[model samples]
Target chain A: MSEILLQIDGREVEARKGMTILEAAQSAGIFIPTLCHHEKLEAYGACRICTVEVEARGRKNLVAACVYPVEQNLVVRTRSEKIDRIRKMILELLLAHAPDAFALQDLAKEYGADKDRFEKEASFCIHCGLCVRYCAEVKKKNAVGFVDRGTRREISFIPEIASKECWNCKECFPLCPTEALQAAFVLTKALFSP
Target chain B: MPRINSATELEELRKGILSKRDPNKPCIAICAGTGCLALGNDRVISAFEEEVKKQTLEAKVDIRATGCHGFCEKGPNIIIYPEEICYIEVTPEDVPEIVSQTVLGKEVIDRLIYTDPNTGEKAAHQSEIPFYKNQMRHLIGNNSKIDPKSIDEYLALGGYSALSKSLFEMSPEQVLEEIKKANLRGRGGGGFPAGLKWETARNAPGEEKYVIVNGHEGEPGAFMDRALFTGNPHSVLEGLIIGAYAIGSHQGFIYTRHDSPQLRNNIAVALTQAEEYGLLGENILGSGFNFNVEVHLDIGIFVSGESSALMRSIEGKNPEPRPKYIRTSVSGIWEKPSNLNNVETWANVPQIINRGSEWYTSIGTERSKGTKLISLSGNIVNTGVVEVPFGTTLREIVYDIGGGIPNGKKLKAVHFGGPMGGSIPESLLDTPLDFDELAKLGAPIGAGGMFVLDEDTNMVDVTRFFLNFLTNESCGKCVPCREGIRQMLKIVTNISEGKGREGDIELLEEISEVAGAASLCALGKTASDPLLSTLRYFRDEYEANIKEKKCRA
Candidate 1:
C-alpha cells in the first residue's frame, strides 16, 4: 500500500493511505481517547471523544480522530488544553443524560471533568452513530437512518414505523457506545409489564 | 422409500408426488411458523387431516405443514397450493368445510380469505396481499414454500450445492477470497466485514479453530434469526459449513437460545439429515475435508450474545464478556482461534458465493454492499421481517414497504437499533441507510430493529426504560457500566418524576464520558447511547420533564 506523510505531536510519521487520524496517531504511539471507534468495526464519530486539534493548510480546528482521514502534510496534535476542555464539556453534557453510565464516568474522570461545569439533562443516546454505521455499513440493512437535520438529527426506521425489512437481529444495539440504540427485550424486561 | 440426498433427487421425488396427485384434489399447506404454533396451528392441521380421512379423500388430497407466512396477526394461517389460495385465522372447527369445499370441490372458502380493512377486498393469495407485495422477501420467502421438518423440501431447492462446491472444488483460501470479494459484513450487529473476520481467523496462529453460529438473539423485538432457524435451518447450516471450510475449522456449533424449542428441534433434525447424507460428518460427499456440527442450547441472558460471553457459555461457564483487548479470533473458545457470526450473517454466505461477490456488492451503497434483514416491531402496521438493499431511504421502508403508520396517527419519533440504539425525530426522514451517512447523523445501524414512535410515547419515559435495562443487565465487571447506569437511571427517573435538579443533565454527561472512555467491553462503553442521543436530539422533551414539570410532546 502507498504511504502518506503526516506530523503528529511534533514528530513526522508515515501512514498507510486512507488511514484515519486516530489510526495514524495510534500507529505513531500517540493515544487519542475514543468511545465509538472500534478496531473490529468502522469509524463512527458520534461519541466525539476522539476530538483532536489538527493544523492543516494553515487552518486549525478540532476534529474527531476516528472519522477524520489523515491527508499528506497534515499536522495534528493529539492532546492539548483546548482539546481537553472540549472533551470535558462533551463529557459533561453526556453525564447530564446518563450520569450512571460507567463508560461516561470513566471518560470524565480521565479528562478531570467535574459535575458542576454544565447543566444536567437526561439522555440515553450520546450520538456516537455506532448503530447507524452498523446498519448502513456492516449489516447493509437500510431499515434505519437519520431522520432529522443538524442538532435535531437522530436515527430512525423507515416512515417512522417498524418495517418488515427489520429482522430484529439486534446487531446494532450492542455496538452503540451510548444508549441511543437499545435492545427491546432488555427494555421490556425492565418495564416488568410482560 | 429411499431418502432424498440432493436437490436433483428431491426434484425427482416431487415430480413423482405431483404426478400422483389427482386433478380434482387440492393441496393444503398449514403454516407451522412459531407465531402460528403459539396460536395452535398444530391442532388445526391435525383436524384437517382427520377430516380428509373421514371424507375418504385421503388418496386424492395432500396435507403439509409449511413455514411462516409472515402475516402474524392472522395466524394460524393456511395456504392451498396450485391455486395459491390463502386461508387466515384458521381453526380446527373450520377444517371440515375446508376439506369438503376447498379440497374436494376446489372452491375458495369465502370466510377464510384476508379482507383489507380499508378496501374490504378479500385477498385469496399471499402474493396479492399488500403487506407481502410491497416488500421483497428474498431469503425469508422460501420459508413458506418448504416444510422445515423435511430435509427433502430444502434439497429440492438446490440447497447444499454450495457446500459441495466448497468441499470439492474451492480451497479454504479460495473460499475466503470469494467472500472478501462479495463484501459481506457481520449481521450480528457490528457489521464488521465478514470476509475480514474469516481471513483473520484463517491466518491467526493456532493449532485449532472453532466456528460458532450465534443463535442467541437477545433483542426484545427481534425474531428474524429465530424464524430463519426454525423455518429454514438448512440455509444457515450451509452458510456455516462454507464458513468453516474457509476458516479450516473441523468442529462447529449452533448456539440457540434455550427458549426456542421449535428452532432447536428443527436444527437437530437438519443436523441428522446432513450427517446421513454425508454432508456434515468427516470426509463429506467423498471429499477429503473433514467437518462436523453440533447444537448447543443457551440459557436466556442478554449479555450471552456477546462473542466472549457466548464462548464462555459454550465452555460451561457463566456468560460474561471478557475484555476486548484479547481478540476472540486469537484467544477464544478453549483458547483457540475462533470465528463467531450471527445466524443472519451465516445465512447470507451461500447466496454471496453462488451469485458471485460482485453481483452481491452491486445492490447497496458504495461502502455498504448487499441487503440487510431487519426485524420490525412496535407501533407499525406491517410488522414482520423485511430485507432491503443498503442505502435505501427510511421513507421508502416506512411508507412504501411498511404501508405507513397504523390508524393515521401523526408520526412522532422513530427508534432505530434497539434499547441500546437511539431515537430519531421525524425531520431527517430523507437520510439514506448508508453507514457513514448515518454516523454523521449520530446513529449507527444496530441489529435491525426499528421501533416507531407516536404522540402517546414519552421520550423521557422511554429513556428511563432503557436506563433501567442497562442498569440490571450490566455485568458489574466495570465501574462505568455498573455504577454509571445506576446513577443515570436515578437522574432520568428523577426528571421523569418531576424531581430533577438543574445540573442533573451536566452530571449525566460527565458520567457518560467516563463510561465511554474507560469501560472494558462494548457493553459498558456504549451503555449510554440512548441517554446521550436523546439529549442531543430531544433535549426539549427532557427539559419539559425536569424544568417544566411536564411530559409534553
Candidate 2:
C-alpha cells in the first residue's frame, strides 16, 4: 500500500491507500464521534455521526468519514459549527426513537442537544446496525438483519436461526446502542419459543 | 428470420423490409400507447379491424395499431397515411365512417379533427395541430409510425443502421469521440454529460464493464420515458447496443418499473426479435462483437431510481443507496465499472450516430443538444408527453404546446424534477428549456416532468406533500435523510394544516441545511430542494399560515 498524507483539524496526518478518513483519524489518535461504525465490519454509514467537511481540489463537501477514503493533500475538518449543528440535530432525531441510549445521551450533552427538541415515538432502535453487522460480518451467523426501509427500518432476529444459534450465543445482545435490540430479542424469544 | 452476418447483409435485410412496404398503401394508424389505450384506443382498434373486414376491404385497407401519438388529451387518435389526415377522439361508431370516408373516399372528417379551443380553428393534419405544430419530435416522432413488437418495421425505418455503422465503420474510441462531441447529457434528472461518463467507464481499469438503461421513471409526473420506451423499444435497444459497443461491454440491463406490463412486454419482444435478427447477441451484425441485455424490475420505490440503489437491486440486494464518494462509472454493479443512462438518453444515441454530431448539435441550444421529451401534466390543458428542442421558452411550452392552464385559471408556477427538484413562478415563464437555464431558476428539468400549477394551488402544501413522499420513499439507511425528512415533514404538515409556529420556518431551514449537507446520497442531499425553493419564492404564504393562521390559497 502507498502512503497518503492529509490534514485533519490543522494537523498533518499520514495514511495508507484505501484507508478511510475515520481510519486515518483513529490511527493519528484524533477524536471523531461515531454511532453505527465498527472496525470489525464494513462501513455502514448509517448513523452519520462521523460526517466531516472535506476540501479537495478546491471543492468542499460534507462526507461520512467512516466511508470516504483518504486522499493526498485532502483537508478534513472533524469539528465545525455546521458539523456540530448536524450532529446535534441527528442526536435529537435519534432521541425521538431511543432517548435513553447512553451513547446518544453522551453525544447530546457534548453537542448541547435538547432531548425534547422533537416529539418522541420511542421505538428505541437507533438502527445503528451494530448487532446486525456484528452478527453477519463477525459471527457469520446471519441471525439478525434489517427489515423494511426508511424510517420504518429496524433490526429483526431470524426466529429459526436465533432459536438454533442465538440461544447458546447471545453475543450480539450487548452491541445494541439502545434497548430496542434486546427488546426485539426478548419479543422473538417469547413469540417463537415452544 | 436468419441473423445477418455482415453489414452488407444488414443493409440487404433493411432493403428487403422496405421493398415489401408500399408507399401508396392506405394505412389507418391508431395510437396504442398506454395513454391512448386507457382512453379506449384498443376498442377503436378492434372497431377498425371489424370495419375493414365487414366492408370487405381487408386486403385493400390496412389498420395498423402503432405507438403513442403524443396528443393524449384528444386520444384515441387516428391518422390515415398517404394523405396523412389526422383524427382525434374517434369512437367505435365513427370507425365505420372513418373507414368509408377517410380510408376509401379520401374525405376528411370535421368532427374528429383537432379544433382550437380558443380560435375555433380546425386542424386536419397532425403537423398542423397547435400542440404538435410548435414542438420538435426527434426522439418520439416515429412512435406513431412503427409497431414496437415488429423488428422488420424498425429495420424498415432505418433503425440498426447506426449500430451497423458503429460496428463496421467507426472504432469504439471514434464512437466515444462523436458522443463527446455531441455533448449528449443524461436526461435522467442530473443532466450530467453522458459522453464523459462513458469515457470514464471506458477508461476505467476493468475489462468487465456493464451498461444499464434506467427505465425506472419513478418521478410522479414523468411518463414520457414509458411512452418512448414502449412505443419505440427497438430505437432504445439499438442505442443501448451502440452504447455498449462504445463502452466495450457485452452485458446491458434495462431497469424499469414493474407496474407497466406493456413497457416490459414491448421491451421483451424487442429483445427477442433483435436477437433473432442478429441485431443483438453473439457477433452482432457479424462484426465479431457480442452483446446481450437483461431486464430487471424495480421493487416499486422512488429511491430505487438512484444509480447506486439501482445497481444494488440489480445485484439482488436491498435497494438502498451508498454515497457516491466514488462515481458509479468507476466502481459499480459488483464493483465492476458500469455506465447507466436513461431510456430517453440511450434512444438519442442511434440518432446521433446516424445523423452525425454536427447534425445532432444543429437542433438544440449551445449546451443542451437535441430535443427533450417532457411529460406535461398537472393543471395544464394538454396533459401528455411533448418533445421539443432545447431553448424553447417556458411560455411557448405552456401556452402554445401545453394549451395553457384549464378552466380559465391563472398560472402560478411550474414544478420540475419532482421531489428532488423545485418550482419556478410564472414570472420566470420566459425562461428557456435549456438544462442550465431551468436549473438556474432552481428547477432542474429532471426527467422532463413539467407540472404547471394554477393560481389556486398552495405552495406550502405542495412542499409538504413532496416532503411526505420523500419520507416514505427514503431508504432509511442514513440518519439525516430518514430523520430529517420525518421531522421536516412533521413541521411542514403542521404549517400546511395551519398550526405553524413563528420559529417553525427557521427550524425547517436549519434541518434542511443539515439534511442537505449530511445525507448519504442524492435522495437525501436533494430532499430539501422543493422546500428550499418554495421558501425562496413563496415565503409570504408560509408567513401568513404561521402568523395569521390562514391559507391564502
Candidate 3:
C-alpha cells in the first residue's frame, strides 16, 4: 500500500492506502467524535456525526471519517466551529428522538449541545442502520433490509408487507440506535394502563 | 433393514417399510415437540403404547412421536396418518378410547378433535384443520411426519441424502455453487447470502477455517431454534457437515444456550448416534471428507447471541463482544477463518441442496427466496413455530396461521424481529414477510420472533421494557450503549410513569443518534430501535403519556 499524504486538523500527515480518515486522524492522535463506527464491523456511516471536511484533488466536501478512505493529497479537517455545530445538531436531533439515551446525552455534553431547539418528533428512529447492517451482514437472514429512499427509508422484512420471515427474536431492537423497536412487555402495560 | 444415514436413505427406508406393512394400517403421529412435552405428551404417548400392547395389535399399529405440528394451542395433539384424523388436547385418560376407537376401530374421536371457533365444525383431519390448512409449512412440515429421536426414522424419509450426495458426488466448490443457486440466505437475523459466506470462508487466506452453529436463542418468546435442536438435531447436523465440507473445516461446534436442557441432550444423542454410524466423525459415509462436531453449551447470557460474544464464550472468555471491523470469516474463534450460522440457517442447507436451488428460490419473494421458520408467540391463539414462505403478510400470520388475536381481541401492533426489531402498527399489517419489505417499514425480520400486541397494550411502556433489557445486556465496553441506553430507559420510564418533560422527546432523539453513531457493536447501535420506531409510528401514544399524563388506549 502506498503512503497517502493528507492534512488533518490543519496538520500535515501521511497515511497508508485504504486507511479511513478516522484511522488517519487517530494515528495522528486527533480525536474525531463518532457514534456508529466500530473497529470490528464494517464502517456504517449511518450516524453521520463523524463527518469531516475533506479537500481531495482540490475538491472539498464533508464525508464520514469512518468510511472515507484516505487518498494522496487529501486535506481533512477533524475539528472546526462549523463541524462542531453540525455535530451538536446531530446530537440534539438524536436527543429529540431518544431524550433519555445516555450515550447521546454524554456526546451532547462533550460537544457542548446542552439544549435542543427543534420541535421533538414523535419517533425513536435515529436511523443508525444497525438492524439493516446486521440483517444484511451478520445473520445473512436477509429476512429484512433497508427499503425506500433516505429519510423516508426504514428497515423492513419485506418491501410492502409485514414480514413472516421475522422470527421475532428481537435482535434488531437492541441493535437499533433509536428506540423504534418496542418490546412486548412494555407494550402490554402501555395497552392496559389508563 | 440396513441403517439409513440421510434424508434420501430415510425416504427409501420409509418406502421399504411401507411396502411390507399393510397400507391400511393406522399410523399415529403424536406431537413430540417441547411445547407438547410440557403438557405431558410423553405420558400420553406411553398410555397409547400400553393400550396398543394390551390389545395385541402391535403388528397392525404404528405410533411415532413426531416433531412440533405447529398448533400449540390445543396440544398434546395426535394426527393419524392415511386418514389424517386430528386429535387435540389429548390427556393420558383419553388414550384408551383413542387407541381402541381411533386406532382399532378407525373412528374419529369427536371430543378430542379441534372445533373451529368460527365455524363450529370439528376438524377431524390435520389437513382440514384451519390452523394447519391456512398457512404454509414448508420447513417444519416434516415435523409432523418424522420422529426427532430416531435418526432411522429421519433416514427412512431420505433425510441425509443431500449430505451423501454432496460428499460422494459433488465437489466443495460444487456445493457452494448449488447453495448460491438456491440463493439460500441465513435464516438467523442477518440475511446475508449463505453460499457467499461459505465461499468467503473457503477462499479466505487460511489453513484452518471453523464453522460454529449458533443455538444461542436468547430472544424472549422465541423457541423455533430450540424446537429444531430438541426435535430434529440430525437435520441441522447434516447441514453443518455440508457447510464444513464446503469451507474445508475439520471441526465444528454448536454453541447452544444453557437454558434448553432437552435440546442440549437431544443434540448430544444425535451426535453420538451420528458418530456411531460413521456419519459425523473421521471420514463420514465412507467419503474422504473428515469432519467432527461437538455441542458447546453457552452460559445463558443474552450477549452470547452476538457473533463476537458467542466466539468469546467458545474461547473460555467472558461473553462480551469485541470490536467489529474484523470479519468472523476472516478472523474468528481463535483468529482463524470461521463461518458461524444459526441453527435454522444450517438446517435449510441440506434441503436447498437436495431439492435444488430453483425449487428453493421458487418459494419466497424475489429477494428473499425460500421459507422461514418463525416462533409466533404473545397475544395469539396459536403460539408455536410456523414455517412460511417469505413475503407472507403479517395479517396472514396473525390471522390465518396464528388464528388471529385470541378471544376476539383487536390487534394493535405486531412486534416483529424481537428486541432489535421495530413494532408495526395495524396500518402496516399488510406488509409481507420479506427482507426488503420489512426494512422499508422501519423493521427487520430479526431471529423470526413475532410478538402480537393487542389493542390494550401500551407502546411507551413497551419501549421502556426493551430499553431496560438492552441496558442490562449492554457489554458496557462502549459508553454509547451503556450510558445511552440507561438514559433512554430513564426518559422512557418517566414518560411511562407520566413524568415526561416537554423537551424529553428531543432529548431521546439526540441520545439515539449518539448511540447509533458511536456504539461499537450492534447491541448499542440498535438498542434504541424500539423507542425510535415507536416514536415514528406511535408518537401519539408518547405524547399522550407526556402531555396528557395518561396512556390512551
Candidate 4:
C-alpha cells in the first residue's frame, strides 16, 4: 500500500489513504480527545470531542476527526484556541448532563470545563451510541438500538432479541463510559421479566 | 391501456382526452385539502354529490373535489367554473342554494362570497380576491385546478409533457445544463443548487444511483409541501421521472410525513396510475429509460428531515445523522450515488423543461431564480400559502399579499426558517427575499416559512419555545448538539420565567459557538440560531429579564 502525506499540528506525517484524522494523529504521537470512538468498531462521530479545524473543499470547517478521512493537501489543526474553546463547551455540556460518568469527569477537568455553570438535570446516559454499536457490530447480537430523539433519546435493549441472542457473557456492559447503561439494562430486564 | 411507444403517441392521447372534455360546462371545485377537511369540507362534498344526483343534472353539471385553494383561513371553499365565482366558509346547508342557484341557474349568492376585512367589499371571483391578486402563484396555483385522485385532469393540463420532452427532445447532459442555467436552488432549507447536486451524482462513479424527494416538510408553520403533494402529486412525479432520466438513476423514493395519510395515498395512486400507463416502470413510454419510485414515510422526527439522517431512516436504521465528510450525493443510501431534492424543487423541474430555462429564470431575483411558495400564517389576515418571486420584500409579503396583520396588531418581527432560523425586526422588512441576502441579515430564509410576530408576543418566550423544540428533536447523536441544546434551553427558559442570571447571555453565546461548530449535522449546528438572533436583536428583552427579574411584556 502507498503511504499518503498530511500535516497535523505543524508536523509532517505519513498516513494511509483511508485512515481518519484521529488515527493519523495517533500514529504521529499526538493525543486528540474523544468519547465515542473505538478501534474495534466503525467511526461514529457522535461525541464530537475530538473535533479539529480542517480546510477541505474550499471551506474551513470544524469537523470530528474520528470520522474525517485523510486526503491530499489536507491541513489539520489538532489543537488551537478556537478548538480548545469548542471542546471545553462540549465537555461542560456533558458534565451538566452526566456528572457522575468517570471518563467524562476526567475529560472535563482536563479541558477546564466548569460543571457548575449549567444546572444539573439529574440524568445519566449521554447517548454516545457506544454500547448500541458494540452489540450490533462486535457481538453480532443486534440486541440494542437508540430509541426516541434529542434529549429524550435513550439506549433501549431489545428485550425479545436480547433474551434470545445475547445469552453469552455480557461483554458490552464494560464498554459503556457511563453507569447509565448498567441501570438501563436492569430496568429493561425488570420490565421484561415482571 | 397500452404503453405509449413514442412522444407522438403521448401527444395523441392528450388530444383525444382534451377533445372528449367540454370547456364550456360548469364544474364545482370544492377544496378537500387537509385544512379544508378539518373545516368540514367532507359534508359540503357529500351534499354537493347528493344534490347533483337527486336533481338528475349529473350530465349538465360536474362536481370535483379539488385540493387546497390557498385561502385556508376561509375554507370549506367552493369555486364555480366558467363564471369563476368563489364562495368561502360553505356548509352542507348552503349546498342546495349553491347547486340550484350557481350551477343550475347561473346566479351568485350574495352572503357566501368572501368579504374583504380591510375594504369590507365582497369579491365573488377567485381572480379578484386580495390574497390571490397581488401574489403570483406559479407553483401552488395548480392546486385549485385539478382533482388529485383523477390522472385525467392532470393529463388534460399537460402534466407529463416535460418527461416526454426529456426523453425525446434533450440529451441527459442538455437537460442538466438547462437546470444549471436556470439556477434552480433546493427549496428544502439547505438551498444548495439542484443542478450542481445532480451533476455530482451523475458524474460520480457508480452503476447504480438513486433519486429521493424530501416531502418531509417538518418545519413549523409550513404546509406548502403537503398542499402541493395533496393537490398535484403528478407534478412532483413527472419532475422526479424527468430528474431520474437526467441523473441516470432507476430507483427513487418520496420520503414524507407519516401523519399525512392523504399525501401518501395520493402519491401511491399516482405511482400506480403512472406505472399502469407505462410511464414509470421499465421501458417508460417505450423510450428504454426504466425508473421506479417508492414512498417512504418518515419515522416522524425533526432530525429525520436531515439528508443523511433521512437516508439512514430509509436504510432501516435509526434516523441519526452521520458525518458528512462524504457528501450524501457522492456516497449515500448503501454507499451509492444518491440525488435528493426537496418536493418543491423537484416540482419545478417539469416546468423548467416545459417552458425553457430562460422563461423560468425570468421570474425571481437575479441570484435566487424563480418564485417561492410561502405559507402565509401567524398573525396575518389572509393565512394560507402564497408564491411570489424571490426578490419580493418581507414588507410586501406581510402587507400587500398577506393583507397585513390581523386585529390591528403592530408587526413586531418576522421569523423565517422555523426553529433553525433567526428573527428579523420590523424595520428591516424591506430586505429582498434572496437566499444569500436573508443569511446576511441574522434571519436566513429556511424552507419558505414566514411567521409574523405581533407586538404582544414576548421575544424571550419565543426564543425559549424554538430552543425547546430543537431540544426535543436534536437526535442526541453529537455531544455539542444534544448537550449544548439542553444547556441553552435551560438558560432561555430561565430568562423567560423571570429566573435569569447576569451571565446567562454570555454562557448561551459560548454554547452557541460550540454547537454551531462541533455539532454533527445542521440540526445541532443551527440549534442556537433562534437564540443567537434573539440575543443580537432583542438584547433589551434578555437584559430586562436578567437584571430586573421580570419580562418586558
Candidate 4, residue B94: Cα displacement in angstroms equals 1.4
Q: Can you list the residue pairs that collide in candidate 4?
A: A150-B475
Reference contact recovery of candidate 2: 0.85
Provide the TM-score, chain A, model 2: 0.94
lDDT by residue for model 4 over B1-553, one digit each (tens)? 6667788999998898899889988899999998899999999999999999999989988898888888898888888997989999999999999989988789989999988887899889977888788778877887877889878789899989999999998999999999999999999987899999999999999889999999999988889988998899999999999999999999999999999888888899889989988889999999999999988899779889899989999998778788888899999999999999999999999999999999999988888999888888988888888888999999999998788988899999999999999999998999999999999887888898989999998989988889888889888888888888888888888988899998889988988998998888999889889888888888999999989998996
> What TM-scores do the predictions have?
0.74, 0.98, 0.79, 0.97
Best by DockQ: 4
DockQ of 1: 0.03
Worst lDDT window (10 residues) for model 2 chain B?
B58-67
Deviation in angstroms for A168 in model 2? 2.0
Candidate 1 per-residue lDDT, tens place, B1-553, comes to 3544544554466566556545545678888988898899999988988888888877777788877777776788888877878888899999998877877668988889988776798889877877667666767878877788877677667677787677666788888999998878888778788899998888889768999999988866777788777888999999999999899899998898888778888899899987877678776666666788878877766777888888988899667676543478877999888899999899988887777788888888988888777776677776767777888787777765666678887666777766567777778777777666665565666777777776677888888997887766665443456556767788899898888878888878877776666455667667788788889889988887778876676
Which stretches of candidate 4 lie above 4 Å from their native place? A159-168, A179-194
Alpha-carbon runs more than 4 Å astray in model 3: A1-12, A15-110, A113-194, B1-24
RMSD in angstroms between candidate 2 and the native structure over all alpha carbons: 1.5
Candidate 1's displacement at residue A143, Å, is: 49
Candidate 1 chain B lowest-lDDT run of ten? B1-10
lDDT of 2 at B138: 88
Local error of candidate 1 at residue B196 (angstroms): 0.8
Clash count for each candidate, listed in order shown? 113, 2, 141, 1
Model 4: per-residue Cα lDDT over A31-102, one tens digit each: 998888888999989888899998866788788999999987788998889998987887777777678888
